[model samples]
Target: MLAFREFVRAAYPLLSPGASITLPCKSGGGGMRPWLMLILRGRTRQFVNEGAIMDTIERAGFEVACMDEVASWADVGAVAREVDACDVLVGAHGSGLTNMVFLRAGAVVVQVIPWGKMEPYGEGFSGALAAHMGLRHVMYSIAAEESTMYNRYGEDHPVITDPDVFYRNGSNAKFYWREQNIWLNTTRFAPTLQMVKRMRRE
Candidate 1:
């Protein structure tokens, strides 16, 4: 992790000189609390009720920072710096969760698996990465109704009822990967936040 962080610093000459890339709230100050970095997706697989999730995060006593609001991909250093400061990173299954590499060891990653049978992909993508980086990983798999797919393809539709049969053909995978968005169920998601809190405490 130190080697990778150094590689990032060396690669980005424009990064602020002497910028301390360290996790905040580690020493127990007045502001000591888990700093959560929420990744926001504007296109596909977005969190429709992001505001409610933010509310739940705050209610759980985490200091929230939206990824999009903190740094753009254009500035790798800025992204790394912001991520380095966060003790927790939360996002739906997507490319955004790749930022886990920038996080320090022992930080927690909460990956929200979208409603299809997307658990395998979520684990293969971010979950494994988090584990390899020595970070705690939590997965929140959404129910059928929690997905916007429920509205697009009603309750009885094979896509919602039986994803295995629906995705038998490899060609059908794009529908779930590119065409689905999530309307996260905050009621179901709140417990996941609490789990993260407990993991952080441990």
Candidate 2:
């Protein structure tokens, strides 16, 4: 596997890094607030209800900011500097999660897990990456109703009802990764934000 540092240095060159995002809540309720950097996906897969995510974060008592650079192979140093400023880096399972390397030590990496492929790509992979970098890792498993797949395939489709059946092969696995986007069930996901807020204190 390519080293995390090496992968970050060579991300796409077209997209420009967005304005530095910062978290506003620190500790459970003290010290400088911790910032959450939500890496927005520019292409197909996306956080369809981003406002809800920000609202949930604020409600969880952490300052949060969204950014547009994760898809771009932009300036690595600039991205690193901005990531270092944040206390948490949150993104869905995708290349953008690679930004975990830039996080400050003890900062949290919160992965919004995608469907079917949740185990390896979503939580397991990055949890290992976070540990390798001395960072904390958390996962928000998207509920079936929250996934676009639920609507497209309807609740009965194998992918929606039995993801294990859907992910039996590599081609189907790719479909899960490429076609699925999340309409986060913020009510359920809020606890995850609260979890990250608690992690910020330590």
C-alpha RMSD by candidate, in order: 4.6, 5.7
List TM-score per model, in order: 0.84, 0.80
What is candidate 1's lDDT per residue for 1-202, written digit by digit as tens? 5456446545654244233434322222226667788888868888888788877787777877776623348676677777777788999888898887777678899998887788999999878777766788999998989889899879999888878875777744676778788888888888888888888888
- Model 1 residue runs over 4 Å out of place are 1-30, 69-71
Task: Show where candidate 2 strays beyond 4 Å.
Answer: 1-31, 69-72
Best by lDDT: 1
Model 2 — which ten-residue stretch has the worst lDDT?
12-21
lDDT of 2 by residue, 87-191 (tens): 788888778888777665678898888766576766557888788777888887788888898898898887877766655654665557778888998889887
Which candidate ranks first by TM-score, i.e. highest? 1
Give each model's clash number. Answer: 0, 8
* Candidate models: Cα lDDT each: 0.76, 0.71
Q: What residue pairs are clashing in model 1?
A: none
